[model samples]
Target: MKFYFFNAPAPASLEVFRQEYVSQNLKKLRLAAYLAMSVSCGIIMLPLVFPVLNQTRHATFYRGLNISLIFSSALALGFEHVLTKGTRKQPPYWVGQLLCLGFAFAFICSCLGITFIAQSNPKNTLTMYLLGLGTVAFLWDFDYLETLVLVALTSLAFTLVVQLSFLSPEQALLNHCMSFVILVCFYFLSRIMYSYRANHFLQLKEIEEKNLEIQKMSQAKSEILGVVAHDLRSPFNNIEMITSLLQKKNLTPEQEQQYLGLILTSCQTSRNTINELLYLAREEQLEAIPLERLDICELLQQVQQEWQSQLQGSKDLKLLHPPAPLYAQLNKDRFHRIMDNLLSNAVKFTPANGKILIRVREEKKKLQLEVTDEGIGIPERIRPLLFERFSKARRRGLQGEKSTGLGLSICRQLVEQHGGSIDVESEERKGTTFHITLPAVK
Candidate 1:
């Protein structure tokens, strides 16, 4: 469904092929159609002016030809309007392409039809009119095949006109040569524009892609400075409090060890968060740090156990898995954060008597893990950007606790780095399910 004018990438679908092939240069296409009509009108009517300006033999015939050209242009213009409306109102894709080509076809017919209405003598009027329409074609975004077809149509039209009309041998040969030169001119003209448009579309697409990246980078900066500020500041406060305690002269040995351990854990946690922020700053992707084989079902079991203690007054939380361990290669720490984020959201949202299920399965060589919670689901308005970085994460938990939006966003990055994907299904007031897919080890 693609033709090489200057050789660009093929369209992804038939409709896409129609769009790129036809509408990419829509403005030029419109201009060509209008120009062809406007000038053809003048050429057709020029014979009527010849009677007043100079000697004219076939006065009645020229007048009739002029009237026909005017009528044809009007009819073609009407088709143009219908095609334009049909294209916009969601008609079939082919309809627009065909109508656009209809303009060219009308131009060819009228150009030849004029010959039958002209004086039976040698004059370059027909040649000029045909060539004028051809010139208009050059301004359009026709592919090489389209241009070749147009050239053939013009050649055939001129041949018919020559055989049917009265012309000297000299004039006939001259028109043929002129037509050859003009067709070649259309060839090079179409090629130049074809390449220009390809490059033009390519650069525009790249700019759009880069613009998205820049927006993400901007959002990451705001997150690091605004959302992560609390996480960073809380750890620093813990370190300061431990430092203050250390300054007391008579602290017991066990107490001192516990304080030091608390300080170490806080510092490590802060360091991990800072590392993720730095990774976001320096590169677009989080480098997949070395991974070890871990049993995913055991991982979920540990997560459920941790949540049981964390959510003491909460609803029933269950882990469902097969007897055989499902293993995958993953960075343990990052994997823990991914599961913990999803689990924490489920725990935070579920009511005291509601149910939550973390299920795991294997399908088509991929591992599927889904966390389903019967709690207040995501709002319809905010669902689209749930995993977008820098999007406000202001949803209230069952207990009215607010969340920092960065968790799900970070989880997405971590999952992608592991060659996995995450998604959520939710309905207002019904519940939410977070789904994860990853390559599984045999």
Candidate 2:
């Protein structure tokens, strides 16, 4: 059997997919700020390590370092806002990459200059540069392998820088090793956090989709139940009426024949109504059979033949179509019910001498079948709920017959189940039209 995808859009582009990544980044912004605060605290304690804090030159050096930390923190806050805004209209990926690289370089230069002015020593510069490289690597969109490489390289670079700084190589090496261990821990912690947030967001989306599907299923079930209750009652009522009439005694041969005919017709109506209900129940229970290719034109013609006896006494019941055959991928039983419902409604509503036209045509990979009737059209107030279950509209015909009000609702459900749509247009006291559009078989 052939299958067709529903109306959902195709998979989104990478930029759109990156929007989810940005949401995860928002949570990290708070942690990043905390890290910045800790770094600022370290910068403030640097003066305690120096013996000449009372000197004007040393005091100015400490003040500059404090100012730089505050400036970096403020810039970091602005970057947090940019991430939160979540706008896709930002510059291309390459532009964002360049901008981030530029910021990293500027921050590295600032840290190096501060260190140089304070001690006039280039020995500890490599330690600061390694830390800067770690921060820069964190900001880049690096894969897992790249991140591991960056962490290892930064650790090695920091170890070398510290070893060259002091007279005692052993103490310097121990300190550098400790700092490298901390950097590695922070890197892994960030990676774990990112993974957790991504999984959580996906879980939330899946729950939402399931909830929506449940709601649709519940609604469809309710509609089917309501329609079945109403449609089933009508035939039972007719059976009661026919039995009541048959109880009369001393009837002529012609009267008996008429009563017998009425009984037969009522039984057939009852059977057809039950079949429609069964179809609706099956669909609601999620037992909808697969669709297959069927000749729609032949299907409609057969439906017309089934109702030929009823329409024979009426006037101007016409089937209009081109000679070419039209085929569609649909459930034959369900499509038959749809056509039967439409035709029955048309015949019941249209007056004697009024026209009922059935037309099937093809348009660009779709099959369009329409049934138009010159009948007492639907009222505007009732039209809104015309396809709703148990919604009885104003019924007027040549003999003023009533309706079960389930036919249109069943037709709509059947059409939708076949991956098609049905619509109605009517003008009160003028005419009514029902149009069904189905996907043409490939």
Candidate 3:
């Protein structure tokens, strides 16, 4: 009793979504055109079919009917050509309307053609087969109202032909029933087509979005490589220069040690840079590292002791936490690497007399860790890219220690492996605080 109509107009995003999928629609239209041509080819050769069947008596009438049907098929196929004339672009708003009308008109002629053949050969099963083919092709891309129109016009054409066809009343009744059957089959088949088009378009949209995302990531990767290449050139030059200095014929022991130390430092810096690049390049491997329950207090204690020995008690490094065994699911070695880089950065940036704070607590059923440094903090402009590879956040420590601009990025990657995230807060000349949050376990 009730029926819906043309798909409700979508949101602006879906309108844009539709624009992206013009190629798929155009391909469907081309295939439909070919299908129409196939039907027309058979109809155009109907005179030969009559002669082969030894029915030359009515071959003239069937030939004329087939000619009209062929013209209609040609016209319908011509409309489909509009989509293929040039490079694929967004289809016009009326493309669906025009295409459906074309198919509908062709279908009307096809039904009349079938009526004539069936009336001439009352027991011809070919009428049923042709009706099925024309209905499917006509309603392939039709909406509810459009489908209703197709069926009505086709039924009207079939009825008019039957009345003028001069077949017996019994034959007319049988063909009328067959018409009803074809219309019902077309109605449900068109509904299925509606679902098919929607899903097909949705898949294209997703693939397009993923391709765009991969393209953006590829561009970013290239930029990072360029920065890495530029960064590597200097330290490698330093190492080569220092290697040459070590080869002097005569040199003092202290002087020799100093040059050797410089070479070692250069090698270490280059190694760290390459390690960061490899980690970023192969992030998928990080997912395989399994996590285990880790004691937060013990880890922070180890970090403090390590830094205590490294900085030689020159700066105040404090570990702040509540007196509890705060446990969390974490990969210990990876987490240690995260803390190592953060503390190394804290020590490098904080002035000798400045303070560094490592705080851990439970917040919202998650473990929260913050590394606060009271030294040259990040500039507001650079803070956004602080964790990005080869970021503009690169800065010399208070002691003029070289920065690879890779430490925070490595820390973030390691944290993410444990199903957590890292963030930072800072103000120039005042201090910077880096926060790491992970899901806490009881």
Using TM-score as the measure, which candidate wins?
1
- Lowest summed lDDT across 10 adjacent residues in model 2 is found at 1-10
TM-score of 2: 0.59
Residue 230 CA displacement from its true place in model 1, Å: 4.9
What would the per-residue lDDT of candidate 1 be over residues 1-442, giving only the tens digit for each residue? 2234645455543234446656533445466556655765676667466646335555566556556655665665576566566555543555555555555655666655555435454554456455556655555556556667766877787777776665668887876777677667766766676566656665666688899989977866766787577767887899999999999989999999999998998888687667656654543554556778889999889888988787784678899999999989888778888988888788778888789999999899899999999988999889888897655645767776545565688788888888899999999789999999999996
For 197-233, candidate 3 gives per-residue lDDT tens digits of 6566666777999999899789767867786788778
- What residue runs in model 3 are displaced by over 4 Å at the alpha carbon? 1-184, 191-228, 246-253
Query: Each model's TM-score, in the order given?
Result: 0.70, 0.59, 0.59
lDDT of each: 0.71, 0.64, 0.73
Give model 1's TM-score versus the native structure. 0.70
Better of 1 and 3 by TM-score: 1
In the predicted model 3, the residue pairs found to clash are none
Candidate 2 lDDT score at position 106: 50
Q: In angstroms, how far off is 257's CA in candidate 1?
A: 9.3
* Ordered list by TM-score, greatest first: 1, 2, 3
Candidate 2 off by > 4 Å? 1-195, 205-277, 380-384, 389-405
**Angstrom error at residue 204, model 1:** 3.0
